[model samples]
Target: MSFLKKIQQPKFLPNFLKVAIPFFVLVTIFSLAINSWSDIFAGDFAKVAEANFNNGKWKAFFGYKIVFSAIYGLYITNKNMK
Candidate 1:
């Protein structure tokens, strides 16, 4: 398909990764820091997992990260193409 061909261009993957990887890492770290702040302060790191599991925060965090990263990557890639 034409869309596939466009994305197959040599620069496409590098351009997407250039924006996506760092963004994902930074955002993920920031999110983890925020979410674990209380546990960190209390020095009870084990509770972090229990809280996240009970509240389903982990699912939301992972979902948002994956979705946003892909969207941002595609947006940047398309912008670079133009």
Candidate 2:
């Protein structure tokens, strides 16, 4: 199929972070979510995430995501937007 031709394109390769970075971020988030859900085995995931965030046991809950998204946005945002 013609679609396969896109794979052979020589543009982003070699320096492939242009494609790999976003994918790695998404997969890492997904894995963290799955592990966070592991507390469901004890039937108490809700309590854990709440304790971590609400009690400030571990800071940067939303902060990490916010900062990462911002940095990723800065790097990934279309330059044409500026």
Best by lDDT: 1
Model 2 over residues 1-82: C-alpha lDDT tens digits?
Answer: 2323433555424234454466557755664566566665587867757755567744556556556655554444332122
Best by TM-score: 1
Query: Candidate 1: lDDT of 19?
Result: 89
What's the CA error at residue 37 for candidate 1, in Å?
A: 1.2
Tell me the spans in candidate 2 whose CA falls farther than 4 Å from its real position. 1-35, 41-43, 57-59, 79-82
| Sequence-dependent TM-score of model 2 | 0.43
The deviation in Å at residue 79 for candidate 1 is: 0.9
